[model samples]
Target: KPSIAGKLDNIQGDIWSKGFPKYYETYYFFSIKTPLLNEKNLFSQCLKNLSTQSPRLISTLRMVREDHNRISTRRKEEAIKQGIPEKRVVLPEIPMSNALIAFTIKGLQAIQAGLQDDTSLRLTDVAATDPAFFAGMTPKEVTALLKDPDQDTWDPLFRSTEIHGMLKIGGSSKGKVEEHLKNIKGVLKHGTAIDDVFQDSPSTPTDSRVDGWTRPNDRGKEHFGFEDGISQPLMNGIDEQEPGTNANTDVNMYTDPRLLIVTGDTKRESSIPRPPWMENGSFLVFRKLEQNVKAFEDLTEQWEKKGCESKEHMGAKLMGRWKSGAPLAVVNFYTEDSKDPDKAKEMNNFIYENEVCPVSAHIRKTNLREDLTENDKDPRALRTKIIRNGIPYGTDYKGNENNTKLTRGLLFACYQAHIEDGFQNMQVNWSNDSTFRTGHPGQDPIIGQVAQKSRGVNGDLETFFNDKFGVRQSVKFQQLVTMKGGEYFFVPSIPAMSDDLGM
Candidate 1:
């Protein structure tokens, strides 16, 4: 509502007030065996309690702009010492514990038992309510893109029937996180949280990929050491809390970016008005992607041994950005140590048409922002955006690959308004299609799903020694990251959770 122009602040509290809380997070999956009434009531009451307990909620009169001048002055002095531009310094606030929950179709039915008529239809229709959610990802007819197949051939957990619901608990510190988990454990026990709660669904986490600070100084980076989470589309309608006010309702919101990247698709008849309960909500896609660190390291070592101009470019072309988070199009070189804050200002301000960065580069293929029509600000690119909010789970191995037994990877989570247009289109129409964005650019070497035999200039989108020119020496990359567990869910707004949806 803050971004809706003349409306009041979203009273449910901005989900990002603490700005990505918890250094450690756990995705607690659950299913129910209790009566439908008990499950629904328990979840509803818990939400009411959580609404008030959500960390850093903007319900005060002084947190808004109260210490802006004083804080800005301190920030400026700190920026000078850190060598960052004064305007870019983000003031740190002590974070607190936060919690959120999501439910699948089976999970929803277990709760809303009475939301049915002769056919048993619910008042609020969520992703679980739609057949498409259970159908999972597929090659949409027009898009003609390949998708992670719905078979045992793919990861079993990702097979629609694996996960029911996930309770995500995060806190500012390890102690707080553990404490929150303990409290939630108590709440979820004795048939309140679920009918039968197992610690995990796909058995216990065997080899965890959880680690810390994958950046120069903890910028968003993946375990592979490449900087992550750049080029995120601005959530225009949502505004942050300011000082001296409970929320930024009448103040800072005036200047909040008004460009909404996730608007409702008016062209899609079934989704024109969207569901009333789904107005400000978004779809949450979860994937438990496992990364083989040693394997990735081996690939890099191979490239390093064959020293050449494009040796460094090899890694950059794989992701479209250097490990330092600098985009290849902007830096024009693979710099391993440049962590300049200024680079972020234009991290997403370049294109790869002339092949400065290969067309099949991971970033270019997923975004296609400026490549749409040579126009940098293409609205078409906006529709395919998703807000990624994943966290690195598990820890690393102890020794070399030979003596290691650690399992680690990313808890890949992304929010989009439309599953088909946002997540599906990117995977099928763009990332999987070598012919997309440019002529036969090849598959996304990072996450593309074509079999090795299908890989080529057209079908598989193999990585060209230099894809810019018609290079014949194309390297077919194997799948390093594997999809182990996945689920499609709807993250309802606070109002939808409590009042509008009749939870």
Candidate 2:
């Protein structure tokens, strides 16, 4: 059907190659679980037949600048044949296959009040969209829609208010994620509040939660054994910079410069303009997180049987990387030297201001990039940048962690424009802050939510390994990532979700 009407004009891949897409991909997470039913053409013609099917979006203006100018001319001919002094490398994309969707301001007013008594759509067709998507906004906008992460700080099996929208199929074949879930079960097999929000249909629904991806060598590792999507950010703008121009801005910092600059792009007008039919929309922030892989391999194998320095260096110092994604501030503790192979393509380039990678690690408290750039005006550290696209539901051990009874961990997604300036200011000011903006570096000992001192906000991660060793280091414990369910979505622009909520 002209390739399913060319997926209503593509555009979904981001977060560096479809948020780390590549290698036998086959994820599917869906979870609408019904609610808002005033019956507007059953969830707007099942999201306008999921925007006419070829929808595994692909429109970020062909991510390439001559493949980052041939990997920066092969890292300047391998740094002038190994004498060193040539680094910055990026190639970023290459994967694409689609199925994506996201919505929830109660699923866009349950499809704008299910197409508002259809005299053919109006409310000024979504009431001039985005006053933070309608009817008098301001519930303090977004700090996770004012908490309810499962009644009192999480783990009621992650109940953050019954999900209303999020389909996200993504492929690389498990029969292309079941033919994009059989075209979303033939658009919810003749909908009824959309087949009671699809629990693989038969009109199920009462409760459901799903998360997938585990093939690319067990999805490039995150079942708590390190190696995940790797750090990300970059969107660049220099009148699209000339001269062999190939500024890769890793999956262009989660895109959506109001689609692609000011006919829609005008950086967050005092925070909440985004909605010229949501130019290439993007704002999901789902999270279900649950990892405990036998308490992360029994506290990193008791710090590798007390001969400490090898549970791959205590999971590379609580994840500043080194589960073979490398980057414990330029790869050490466990090793990565092959004649300085351009330091693993400058692993998301470094910095912690000589703190030697430990401003609460977990990618240096979520993206500090070039240490929030000296004076280049770091938009509050690039508005708490995010672009992660999660996957890792369950099953992990043979020593290989938790051999599942379902309910494993990590489905933590993210894509931004504003979920309160990127995932609620990096989950309440940097993974539950321990005095950070630059170093007091506590909490975030691998996805901190708070534990041990239980809600005492002492997930402990302070450090100072050696500056004349005045001594100061830590690695406390508690909820090794456990927020059961979450949501806050938008994902528009499959031709503005088939022309503004398919009205």
Candidate 3:
């Protein structure tokens, strides 16, 4: 038997890889709408294509190993030139094209029913034990549970169509990703037709695909000008072996491997027994969030006019971090992010205390970070942990206050073993709940929703404009990040694809 880490190729790489080479990506959603006579044949052909291409899927373990070797070689070369041992080397950015495939519950049932010899068998016979996976993202009940806006407000493609599965294609450049997508489309052309395509930073008029990319030169920042993808949970087997040890070793940042991987030894005693096919599989939560930058800026300007705080300070208080990725709880001020490498590494180390970072701050609301003492005995933190692999969609706001035509936000995707306890719990139980920790801290200023008219008071956040000024005030923020559309998917292991799905 091999260690889980050794079987890297078995799992979908996007679930583990920080964010796939992410210069550009195309999330191709497809439906199995072939005629009954050709349904099985079409499904099999699509599965076969995926199985054959499984080897090309980027594996995080393999990626880490390759990066480690590359860094070591680079360090040796630098050391030789300097005539001394190299202490540090700037990490090289990997440029590569990759693809990941995941399916909705209906898609899995369709595939199983199409391929399985026994036509009498049902999805329950081979279910993964997650009720949410079966219920999906569009149901009125699920929408209400997630506290998302009305389904009617969502994009027609997501609200009306049955999205069976998605093929995520990403690479070093738009051209490279497009080339990869073309080849993929060509391969699956005989058996399948893409129902719709969602692109990152879509260029043309006909391309209705949502656009996303790392900001040019300013890689990690989103359209809101806030640094993103920081403070990720460090998994036991994966992050420990990765090149960077300084930040990964922090116990506060550590997350149980089972939270993101399907394993028998989960901390939840009441957890349902999962099928063998779900061994390395993980649940993927995909949300297309559209940000209203103009409205947010207008609100910030109004706050700045109050004379209690500057726009920069107010923004950091809301997000719990500066634009440079420095946590307000750690750096205590926005101007403290002075391009120091050592200071940058210390960003995720601090714990929430005395509301140094407001209790309702986006980061604090999403991750309590030692705010609850029960974390030592039975950790709620572990249950809600999710590995985010999202990217900013659209372009820079260009200070256009009235431009509704240019949409920009995040293609928010996260991986976790349990959907109910992870993403759903964070959004519903924590983010939306005003009195989450202690006191009426209000909803998460960034992602939290009011959910109902009764909860309207919870929508306004109370925070100090400046702790030094002692000018505490309540600010009612409009819904800035809108949930346009989304879906839940199951990224199955390679073995599952081959043996169980009949690839």
Candidate number with greatest TM-score: 3
Q: Which is the better candidate, 1 or 2, if ranked by lDDT?
A: 1
Top-lDDT structure, candidate number: 3
Evaluate model 2: give its lDDT: 0.51
State model 1's lDDT: 0.53
Q: Write the per-residue lDDT of candidate 2 for residues 218-337, one digit (tens) a residue.
A: 545678766566454433331232232222242243333333211233345444343366554666667667777777778778766755455666666677766656677765555545
lDDT of 1 by residue, 332-380 (tens): 6645333454554345545455676777778878876544443454334
Question: Model-by-model lDDT, in order?
Answer: 0.53, 0.51, 0.67
- What local lDDT score does residue 173 receive in model 1, on the 0 to 100 scale? 58
Cα deviation of 75 in candidate 1 (Å)? 7.2
Candidate 2's displacement at residue 446, Å, is 5.9
- Model 2, backbone clash pairs (residues 3+ apart or across chains), number: 14
Model 3 spans with C-alpha error above 4 angstroms: 1-3, 34-41, 54-95, 117-122, 125-128, 190-209, 241-255, 261-271, 338-342, 376-379, 452-467
In candidate 2, stretches whose alpha carbon ends up further than 4 angstroms from where it belongs are 1-164, 167-191, 196-275, 279-282, 287-292, 302-306, 309-316, 319-351, 356-360, 363-365, 374-403, 411-415, 418-503
The C-alpha stretches of model 1 lying farther than 4 A from their native spots are 1-18, 34-42, 52-95, 114-131, 134-146, 149-162, 185-190, 195-219, 237-273, 304-310, 335-342, 373-382, 397-399, 451-461, 465-473
- Work out the TM-score per prediction: 0.74, 0.32, 0.84
Tell how far residue 365 is off in model 3, in angstroms. 1.1
Question: RMSD of each candidate?
Answer: 6.9, 20.7, 4.6
Model 2 vs truth, CA RMSD: 20.7
